[model samples]
Target: MSELLNTSEVFASDPSGLLRGLHRQPVLAVLRVSERQQAQHQLNLLVEAGLRHVELAVALTPAWVELAIELRQSFPSLRLGAASVRCLKGLAAAQSAGLDYVVSPILEPDLLAKAQQAGITLIPGVYTPSEVARAQALGAPAVKLFPASSLGPSYWNSLAGPLSPLPYCIAAGGLSALDARLWLESGVDAVALGGSLFETSQGPQQPLQLRPGLTALLAWLEQRANGDLLSG
Candidate 1:
């Protein structure tokens, strides 16, 4: 197996650069599949949707590692990462599968240490100052503001004063086009869309049609990027 890059090394390697590229487009589809076949199908749809980054939740059975490995090999340019990785085992599995990064729903110092030691990017989840502080202490490259909707954009805006120097922040959870502009305006590095982007009907095999909602969301992001709505 190839040696995994530690957290610091991964950050130095410009993991955020990869994220910035993905953000420039508009959306990143986070797929949480329970089956390998379904995961593969979702991967194809994401690619078709013009999304270059994906987060595969590790909580899925049969393991998303297998699918992640296959996709990494097939789409070398695609940024494949693991989410819901709360334990060392999950971290190891993600690294072994050649994941570009690992995201957790909560902060875990040991897991962060392991990821750093192994040389892999880590995006620990944070919903409070203490969690953000813990993640920063671990030298996390970025922190995912999970269940972002609960706290709203103001929460992120508040963090900017103290955590401004910290690595990037991504907002996830209950995110939609209506709120995306506000989140970005609040200083998030990027946003991850789950249920808002994928419907159960659009199962693994079915391709995602660029629906009005999705298109509107994309348009809003684009407008923000162009400085039409977002001020710098």
Candidate 2:
């Protein structure tokens, strides 16, 4: 379980194995919403389409939090977490809503410590090697690279030399579903995709849907997990 994160293998320092589920199906769906009902329907579509890990950004109402907790209970295979968790208030809301994990857009040691005390896994955001090192020192189980699409998929590969055994990494922000294969192949533990996954010829940030493109991406990932596709 402590093997280095290869193409399909998992993390080296995941002692609690909180990320084992992600290793099997390596995409993190991050939903940003302004409507509660829309968020619920979107989440239903994702889980119904067999996507396992989904993060409901706190943009939705706290009522959405209740719905998320309920949906997670209904779908035992689903790993639901809170996104944009930057403060103790968000942490309290997630805790009350019964979220399994929380992700932040910045690395705040105080928030990380608070989450740790509450017995929750906090995956902090980081950009530089120093921030990643700081997160690891803060006892983070994983780290999310914010604005990752701007950095490109090859970014993690460059860090492999400097960081050696990189912390379990999740690439988030501005990533489209089409880039999943590229990022996964480039060695990120997971890619947190947003509504950009549904981007069309019209423009970006379309409503979430299980398009043929996304279905194909999910199929490809499953095949990779089953060893039918090339690991590298």
Candidate 3:
């Protein structure tokens, strides 16, 4: 475990080039399925659709770490990570599998310190201004704004100013395509989606697939990316 925390140059300050690099395609996919094969298949689909960043959040199981490694081997350019990482075991799993980073539900000093030591980027979840300040003080390069849809996209706009230069913000949990548009417009650095893509009136918890809204969201994201390039 010491090797995990003591073997990189980006360990000192912040994610050397992690979150800052997501401006090109600002959508992150959070895969929270129970079946391993299903997760692999869904991830393959996301990659085919041009998604490069994803978090494996299926109960913080080491299942994610294993999947992240496999995905990386297949697509070297892909950015794979584990999610819901809230303890030492989770962090160890993240490093054991050599994932690019890990995401947590809340900021924990020890977890952050471990990430900093390992140079494995950690994007801790934040809700209020005080949490944001603490993350910034900890030198977090980015933070995930969890359950952002609960507060609506406007919440970001409300907090963005006072938290000027906020750690690269990612809006996650229950966000739809329109919500993604609004959050991005509100200056959220990125938006993450998971089971929301497959939600239906049915009560079954199905494994992720290229569901209806997903394709549309991908197309829209691609178009926005092109527009960003042209505008730039």
lDDT of each: 0.71, 0.76, 0.73
lDDT of 1 by residue, 1-232 (tens): 0122355665564354554455466356677776665566667766765566787777544355676777778777578788889998888778778785778888888888877777677778999888887887777777888999999887876766776555567789889755676677666767888877755465656654433355566666666668943565
Alpha-carbon RMSD, each predicted model: 5.9, 4.7, 5.8
The TM-score leader among the candidates is: 2
Show the lowest summed lDDT stretch of 10 residues, model 3: 1-10
| Model 1: lDDT of residue 195 | 71
lDDT of 2 by residue, 1-232 (tens): 1243453332323422458777778788887655556667777777776788888787445776777667667667777788999998888878887886889999999998888778787889999889988987877888999989778888887988778778888999888777777887887888898867543434445654565556677888888788834654
Q: On lDDT, who's better, 1 or 3?
A: 3
Per-residue CA lDDT of model 3 for 20-121, tens digit only, reads 456667788887756657666777778777777877763555665666667667766668777889987888887877775888889898999988888778
Query: How would the candidate models be sorted by lDDT, starting from the highest?
Result: 2, 3, 1
lDDT of 3: 0.73
TM for every model, in the order presented, reads 0.79, 0.83, 0.82
Q: Quote the lDDT for 31 in model 3.
A: 73
**In model 1, what are the clashing residue pairs, if there are any?**
5-119, 5-120, 6-119, 6-120, 7-116
Q: After superposition, how far is residue 45 of candidate 2 from its true place, in Å?
A: 1.8
